[model samples]
Target: MAHFVPRASFSLPGSIPKTYFLGHHHSGANAIKGILNTINLVIECRDVRLPLSTQNPKLESLVAGRQRLIVYTKSDLCTDSPAATHTLRGLYGADNVLFWDKHRPGTTGALLRKLKNSARAIDALTGLRIIVVGMPNVGKSTLLNALRSAASPEKKAKAAKTGDQAGVTRKVGTSVRIVDSEEKGGVSGGIYLLDTPGIFQPYVEDGETMIKVALAHGIKKGLIADEILVDYLLYRMNHWNPGLYSRYCEPTNDVNEFLTAVAKRDGKLKAGGAANWQEAAARVLSLWRIGKFGRYVLDDLSDEAIRAHQHLLVNPHLSQNQAKKLQREERRRARTGD
Candidate 1:
């Protein structure tokens, strides 16, 4: 494990041919950072989560002179696809872009094909080993699994089910090849993959807050699912399902008011006709999880905030030289009104 490095520390990881996935929270940042900060062959991975999508410009600097694959994970659910694709391409160019489904198992073949092609292209000239890095839970493990399975059939068993979460595949590897023994695309020949845990930075939270954080990053533009998520919880408290009473469950309707009605119906009333609000909301969260509320994506941050976040990611460690250069450029532009 990497020592707890301060967020602002800009020291590039030791010289290793690797890839780095950059972002705010996990999703794809933590794992990529680990590979870059420790191993060589690393380039960089961009956290395409809703919040941090276009939020970081310094991210471009991290991918300099390395093989990069723009992974659009959770593509099935995101409301904005074309815009995201365009934004990333506009910034990183179309050559590096790619997409992935978090739950799908077959996409790995497509990815490996692309990687091999890229490696072959770059290998013909310069560069070292290639590293696939990304934020946690951005399908790195799944990608590794698909790669492994694609390489070797016997070694590629279905994901182990423990309970509500995933079971670890111990046979995989400690620090060797990524997809060691598969079949056609097996790592035995050359290609490899490294899987890392989901990254949960200080800013990440579960449930509704998690959605909000993602939106704040500019990873996704606009999603009605977020309000829908909170709405479902609020709706169920009032003894109604989401979208069943669209007008009544409008965003303007007060959540606390909805809680009151829920409390009265659920016998959470106080001494008088008034109902307990907090208790009702808590119960609503439970019910919502149980399908009382429909699936929803909470895009918390607005477009304006995302713009600011993008600005900060780029200027986080602005050096004195950069600052002076920027100041000079600004002054020159101002004088010329250009």
Candidate 2:
């Protein structure tokens, strides 16, 4: 029997979109900037699975010069990449980066303590104002609700609307008090947090970044076909550890073979017992999202990848106008096959 070998590289389809910038994303950026003056601390939420891809360069510029706390949400989903946390903390500051999981109250408590400490330092009568911002579906609203629930146990209801898909919170929300005044042993004036809509970058030059973002549901659903996503996922799984999907089948580069096995095992079959590839792909994605298959970070965390990412953040390859022009050229090429 021959030993299984994964493909050295996954070819990206040109059909993948380079941007998912919606009307809400544009308005959300402007709204966040409009209120930047009133904000004391910015809570930037990012998915633990795709930390680098989830970081919006536009948001970084908007929140520049402000005290920012980088909270990696859904940390439980990337437990396999323990070094990712340490590496991120080293890049940012040990005090600036926090790994958070909604299920873990200890993590939430740690974040609450940080917020309270910041509030104490400010000692503001108007309260320490904070705004939660991040890419779509990265859990900005979810984090806000968690912090609110942790700080104020009496408030059981969620303050911001949340959903699995992107663009759930379209508009900026009113201020929700997370802590009480000094008399109540909270902060000086108390701590308040404003939840903003998730903002996507104006342009994503790398197709792989878009795919990773899509896998994390950072973009609108159906932007990229589920089959394509699962294929990319299968490639990654093979590289990480072929046994990640061993229950379905042996490691193979063919996405159909894997999806067929999944359909048979999970009962995603058509009337005539045909493998429902679409449904199977979605099932795999759902399972991965909940950390069933494996918990791992999608971004390349090697020293080189990190340095390249940092460099790109500091010096973007193209301006907004240039990006638009490049997108237009790509679309024309797609149409004419030039």
Candidate 3:
């Protein structure tokens, strides 16, 4: 007869990786910097589910002086957090933050209009050149294709290659025209966008951020085990609403029990009827990614969380060193049992 309550905190595993930075990511950053002088604007994309986690601090610094617009891609997946848009707009002025949904043409139109306005202001002889950049798998290519399609209705074929997994576009793509010139009722010189490979931060001091990024498919699949990711998902779902998973079973802290119920309901089982936890975990993740369970924002958007995030961005080195020192102290305490 007792009501269910979610845990106040989820313990992160010690094995959680602090970095997903690869060789391609480094090269991608350098490539963006190389073309900074030519780029008139930067369309920085972040997954709505993990706005903070998907932000690459290094990339931000590289393109700091340029005109930037923070587009939260997959906004449809964060409908559960209705106020998330307002909060984000408040953090980074309303004009600077945009919630974009590929499914909604209106959202794409809004972005196109903004791009055209920027192009009109510059009145470049060649064209308004923009570069799309973001963390891995945050929908940079997809956004480029969407903009191109929206601007040029007759162009049926996609200009940029898009995939759900990370590293789909390993190199910088050539410039693709998204708008026509003034005679065609478009911007002054036309609008072109360059799609760049998603670049990950050099290091992530917080393991929880790694888990969140992994859940959003920003990092390579299986970098963190599906089971571990699912556990984190379960914890977050519980905190939001146990009813989010009511279709499977009663809310419980036991990931095994939850996965077993999911396996049985969804037929993710072994030949002998035993639960296939891995497959079940994957299924859960796939469903959540598409917003079957609930459309929620994983990052904490409260005032305190925002302030901490801003502080870290301002003093990244200090935060990283402090985090390392604390990690060392934690390990030492475990060894000493004090």
Best by lDDT: 2
Cα lDDT tens digits, model 1, 153-245, are: 577464321111111221222343433332434323344455443333222212333343332222221222333334433433233233432
Global Cα lDDT for candidate 2:
0.91
lDDT (0-100) at residue 111 of candidate 3?
94
State the lDDT at 67 in candidate 3. Answer: 88
Q: For each candidate, give its TM-score against the true structure.
A: 0.50, 0.95, 0.93
In Å, residue 190's CA in model 3 sits off its true spot by 0.6
**Model 3 stretches astray by more than 4 angstroms:** 317-338
Q: Candidate 2, TM-score vs. the true structure?
A: 0.95
lDDT of 3 by residue, 1-338 (tens): 47888878889889886766676877888898998899889999999999888877888799888889999999999999999999999988999989999999999999999998899889988889999999998999999999999888899999988898999999999999899888888878899999999998867758899999999888888878999999999999998889999999999988999999999999999999999999999999999999988999999999999888878877775465665565455445445645
lDDT of 2 at 227: 95
Q: Where does model 2 exceed 4 Å of error?
A: 325-338
The models' CA-based lDDT, in order, is: 0.43, 0.91, 0.88
Candidates 2 and 3 compared: the better one by lDDT is 2
lDDT for model 1 comes to 0.43
